[model samples]
Target: MSANRYPLEVDVAIVGSGPTSAAYARILSELAPEARIAMFEVGPSISNPPGAHVKNIGDPAARAAAQRASEGPGAGAATVNSPGEVKAGTRQARPGTFLLTEGYAADGEDGLPVAAMSSNVGGMGAHWTGACPRPGGAERIGFLDDLDALLAEAERLLGVTTQAFEQAPLPQKVRELLAAQVDQDRVAEYRVQPMPLAVHRRPEGQLVWSGADVVMGEATRNNENFTLFDNSLVRRVLTDGAAASGVELSDQLTGQQYQVAARCVVVGADALRTPQLLWASGIRPEALGRYLNDQAQVVFASRLRGVEASQGAGAPGAGLSEQSGVSWVPYTDEEPFHGQIMQLDASPVPLADDDPVVPGSIVGLGLFCAKDLSAQDRVEFDDQVPDFYGMPSMRIHYRLSEADHQVIERAKQQIVRLGHAVGDPLDERPFVMPPGSSLHYQGTTRMGTADDGTSVCSPDSEVWQVPGLFVAGNGVIPTATACNPTLTSVALAVRGARRIAEKLNNSLLMSKSDNRMSE
Candidate 1:
């Protein structure tokens, strides 16, 4: 859509422009074409095609700059200080990947110190590793009646495919060796396949990575009802008698604030910040930022014995060497951890020595175990303090339970066994990373079926008691997942989109009814 005037009312106002926000906006535009929608992104649009994946940029310098841009404003500063006070160095999966933690994280509480976010037009969608595995067995949300349908839609929008490296030799070898390591007793639900990735392979032998742009479709272009406002920071969700009425936003570049009315508000501003926004909006609940979960991640690298690296084979210029193999160990009752193995000819997983690329004869291995969810693990805000963005300050308090430690131990054993099957494990490589290192923080605004104190939002992603206010993104994931949460989070947003469409459809019906009554 051509840009619309400011301060105008919109049917729906979406915060954050990652996969979750994109999913909400896209589905709403499709299901309710007449509903006027506006998406507000806090950071500047970094890409020329705005929201295109950094991997899509061929030049090394351009890609690196875009990645850093996604890292948020503090990353460009001479002295970085997003966490309010800095003690430990800011950590991230890669450059242009993570926004520094704003306010305070329980640096002593293990995982909270490293929990981070990304701020850009596309958010984390522009800089993800593209691992899009589906939940299995217990990892699937049992309450979702339309689980399969939602997942299918999310996968379609992400362009997820198992055949991304169907022709790569290294992946086939890794799958074979990894399969041999899995206990024969649990083979039924624990077999392997090529990694599911949100990527498209063109006939020209180039691969285009999925980002918020891919998910947004033409909503930002041809849809007259949809408008994306970049460099606008939403500070609060305006409410009127238990219902969302609008949002208060400020221009990030100019510091000019605007009061834009919205019939409904949906916040998907990553996990940590989503809850922060809710707190800033004075919608705090007992469960608003409780039950914080970051899956215990164990990373290691191993030398490949028989497999040869196809340097330019599957992923082209992208870091993915051979498509990941058996992207899951399958979260089952007996083995609750998930395993991801990648042949890193030019690897992206950071190892102690490898940095970016593992030797051609090496493969990177990772195991993620679901954390035991507890009320004690949480991220709270101090109304008195202000964050880097001048909002309510955040303080995360998290720790691993005894059961969590047991899970981590078992994950270590599992990865070591699988490592032996592939090659020799590198010294100091096969070890558990600090908490939050995985960057898969979840469950802050977790959903439940009711307005229970244990959940901040309803099962459909609407905040409890706030009828028109909703929350999405990883924060709303109620589960302690073993796989990457992007696909599942996007799927959950699909569910929310359907609910929002119904509300919009009813509003239109009521207008017609009122007109007839007046006549």
Candidate 2:
């Protein structure tokens, strides 16, 4: 857990230090107090003295991930130059596919693969809108009872906060909009709770922020057991056949590599990278890189007349006032991905795709996320598209099915209805409309009854083929729920940690009893 020293051995080795990994580490510490656990992160650890990316808003890690995406199949292609040269950025524009690092996604008519989003450190959680919603009955009917318990466990580990937002003022436009909807019974059954956030909330003046640095950050520096390795990129999982024994990693800064062992291994490296790591390690199942799904997101921007100025897009210090809920109801559809609608309060700052006409304004962003029903969407590893470190990048294959289109239409109609209730005319067109805009990647490695079909892990998240290997995060979701996968992933990781602890305890007891009998 020290910056200067690398841990030689650990009871558990967690590949990612994101929300899921964080939850697993915390649970392991509580359940097995004396068990030595080491959490490895490819990025620089979050310190009291924050990096330039977190402090100055430069976000180097994000830049690297973006670069990796850009160099892949569709988004990054070579173009013929005037002076008899081939260029990297001069080809036909393609919407990057969002998928995993190990599987081959089917190409379009032109035979080019799609690109998916990837990140280091807190991963996607760093750029998330922070809206947490649980899956409905329609989404969970197929799984076992342990899923219900795991979902409950997830809520507890996330410090699910519903009453915390009462102290802050509700945005005037949001309040008016919700009031009108309630009066019309359009949202009669649903209740908006405080958005569940992983970070701790601090009182005003209690913590001082000088630019991007939060001096008294307890989440990162205060925990003695919490060890974070920043700027370290994981290359592959080290294993023998299906059994995972250790992890092979490379330092993003120095390009140094090492192999670290663990009693149990948990992978939380997002939907894309998790599979890639598994594949590189030669741990393959028919389901390893298949069934990749992401929440279809459509972004809408509107200028409000009376709302106060927003700090920026995904502003770290900006206060979230009166968090709202994602209202969803189950409607049985032939589609594989569930349909749900979520309302998010986004800052007016320029995002990745901002309209030229209204680049800067009081923008209220609305994102409608749905699931992908088709199995055609997938991921593949390309040796051609390489990063600075020469590690292969994932070629993501993603496209919206008819189900996604219908769900988007429904969400648009709902938005219009809400506008009419508030005595405001709805805008006819959105700023950027896409099939799978919301980046909630999930369901690549699903949990199932056995190893032959429909699963990479069992009901308890144990790798079906390997005893010590475990899968976590959105990558292992059995079904793509309509809600954000972060909460669900964290919950699954916690449940997995508990199961590991139980197995370990039983094994130790049996060994001790055998020794006593022999004596």
Candidate 3:
């Protein structure tokens, strides 16, 4: 069958094939196996047969090249075509197989090195480092009810666990050494502990990172009622009064437009695009694209002087072993910074015949400071200038606050002290990465207890004024949390999917009752 000939109607339509959307699909498939569902993705599907990228994980350069090839010329530049095509020779690929479009940010914001995101089928989850940590009680947003239960379910769905390091003792050693040197009260407040990762460790001691595709691949393949359309960019949600009826989609490659009707619609197109799509569709709530937040990070790297590096560094097995050594200093109610320390493998060196290989190891630390969600930090759309998908061009607005700078200073001091304690002082002071570099953008479509002008979604993740419309992803998180938001976002998506499933089941039951009464 032609790709264009897909079913024009489905029980539910989801936009963006990211982790949040995949999680929603997984849950809905289990809860309502017969529910007809369709997922729309702006980027092309993974290369046929999958696993090509997984195989290249050990070769950073090759992986980067593949990502650049996939991203095309538009990977880092702005485009006005229907589907942004990658330009030739634009190959500063990051450490993944997916490439992100450049120049989406407005003029002033263009200088900021925002964390590049994947536009492919799996979204950022495809390129993520799999760091999964639960937000502390202080980081939880008050507006979201039953946060504990939601998190518990999310952890289960994502396979969040600390088992990966059960055999790796490096983290424990580092934690103990740090604890001994630091004040007991300060150590308790910092809550230093082993970092929890969203990965499954096999019986053979191999780790299987949980990507969106890994999470939903089997379910999508097994469920005949489910369909996925890639390279299909959704331009807008079609609304009937306050309720959504479907969406208008454009094929990124062919520039063809079509409409699909649905009983419910969900938008999980990341933080930036979710609001952009809503605004383009004229469903602009007062706070539709406001209160954007991202974790501002201070990165520090140090080489272990007087130590020899392992011979087989940069290999996949070594990388996994290094990952097992990862540890974290979580933020507390008293302190607003969360820290992580990990061992870095050796870089690829050009070896000479006579040169002896004195391999050395490096340790890197990242101090992430929480930024308060602010209305001024937002995403705006320019309707006059259409992008590759014929949607409004986006502009990102963000600025660091004075308080944020203070936290950075504190983080730097902490890193310096820790470095000295370990006798691996950093070559230089901590470097503060540009805003948005963390890839933790959130709060553009925040959820709140009430549908006030400040929030976009209700507690159930439904659009406040738009019935039958729901949103899932990091953008729905109402708070500025220092920890990675993937697990939390997936959890919220599960919660939202539950609500939508209930609504659809109820509608189906009522329709049957009405039919019987009429007969």
Candidate 4:
């Protein structure tokens, strides 16, 4: 189908539909009750998670079988996406495994990194482990205290359930093992308990908790002002002169081009896709696609012999209880959000790909997230590789710094100490890698005041180059804090949506006043 000839108008246009899109849409609806919004997603609705991302169809019925057997709702959502029968080169290739784009070959000498984006109603949130953490300390520079109010609003709109965690049906041993990480000195060192998440926990059950699926459906979907368009991939911004006026999109399912004009545009494509969208639209700034950050991850695996197989929603092992200048969860400081400590409740066998080895035994994964490397790396559009839609695909060029390595090394030592605290038998060795070797990549279109020339958005997350355009998600984050970026992304979206509504409301009131004066 051809492009919509007349301007398809709305009060706001949200580019992506992850947690950011849903949360912001709620805020906009409340603040501007009469305002119309256009929410576009390049994937299917929540009803069919598999159809949303083609990769979820791996082995055809494999995912469905797994989901039926597993406690997690959508555990079996991926379908292997490789050509033919899963050959050596195609084993890991699955439809929702990573974001896919059809566009130009990247500009880098080595070419762009594999760029994967979630194509679902909830976008990446659908595949997420439901980790929700707010940025603290240095990471709070770009965002103001007004963010707290926004966060509260997000919690309500997103239906975040705190009581959910208390109810997870976890195994007894799993609970003890995770809680043990916070004994005495360990608590003193970290100064916090396990990080609170957005997942719904079944407090009285066997310790099992579903992720964020509880509040996302039906309830929030009831808003009449909130409209969602699935299977619609955004192509580029429709601009007037240099300012963004709206967006041009292609309905992936039907091969149709459409446009949604808004007085304001909000880009919430997360860290990976947000930068490329800005660049594709000619929104330039020193930091548009620079300072690419990711957490460096290392894992230590072993098995607890006496522990029975995991049956319930396992408590996230001390899950997110520790933080330092270089590390947050199982990742380190060198790569910013790179290091993450994953305490997976599972058995261990020798396997490869990404993940560190403990050298012996089976149990759980003690992931080490390293520090953030404040290096200048980035994502941009490759002029050569074009997708079926003919838009430029993203090209990413990134690496870690020496500071990142030291953080990982220190993390290994801490992992050993943590093992001791939990009284678990563990191998004292750790696997290693180059900084940024593990992807949790973020921070391309950072937000800051005008004084910080590297930033593309203001403190309020408004794009400097395009006044009406705002950015939410990891792309606009000034720093990659030790926590997962989703909660903060939602918070920022709420904040930005309020700003958009206020501006539009003021504009309408002024226009009406002028009309009356003219009469």
Which residue pairs come into collision in candidate 3? 72-86, 72-87, 73-86, 73-87, 74-86, 74-87, 76-102, 81-388, 82-388, 309-359
Query: Model 1 over residues 1-519: C-alpha lDDT tens digits?
Result: 134346479899999999899999889988888999999998878885667777777778877777677767457644332211221344533566554455335556564555667778988888776778888877788898888889999998787888866765567777777888884767565676666888765466665677888788875456798888888889999999889999999888778778888999999998888999999999998998998899888877787675444443344555344444334456666788887776653334443344343344567788889888898888888889887788887787888988999999888888888888877777543577667767788999998887769999887999988989999999898887888889999999999999999999999999999999999
RMSD of each: 3.9, 7.4, 5.5, 7.4
What 10-residue stretch in candidate 1 is worst by lDDT? Answer: 79-88
At residue 448, candidate 1 shows an lDDT of: 88
lDDT of 3 by residue, 1-519 (tens): 266755788999999887889887888888877789999988765533231223224455654444543453346443212101111223333433222344435555422244455667777776566777888856787766777788887777777777666554445556665566554776453566767776665466555555676557566668888888887889999999889999998877787789999989999988888998999999999898899888887766554454434432333532254323566777776668777666542111111111232222355667788886579888888899876567787677777678877877887888777766555654556667656667788899999878778899988899998999999899999887888898889878888999988987888889899999999
Q: Which residue pairs collide in model 1, if any?
A: 67-96, 68-96, 99-117
Q: Give the alpha-carbon lDDT of every model.
A: 0.78, 0.53, 0.70, 0.53
TM-score for all models, in order of appearance: 0.91, 0.73, 0.86, 0.74
Off by over 4 Å in 2: 1-5, 46-119, 167-176, 179-199, 203-226, 301-317, 321-367, 383-385, 423-426, 510-519
lDDT by residue (11-124, candidate 2, tens digit) is: 678877666776777677666655566677654433224321221233557443443442233334432211112112222222222233333344452112223443445544
Q: Which ten residues in a row have the lowest lDDT in candidate 2?
A: 207-216
Off by over 4 Å in 3: 1-3, 47-66, 69-73, 76-111, 181-183, 186-190, 201-205, 304-314, 317-319, 322-324, 345-360, 515-519
lDDT of 4 by residue, 70-162 (tens): 212223445443222222323221334343432212344222233345456666555454555455545554337587776666666555543
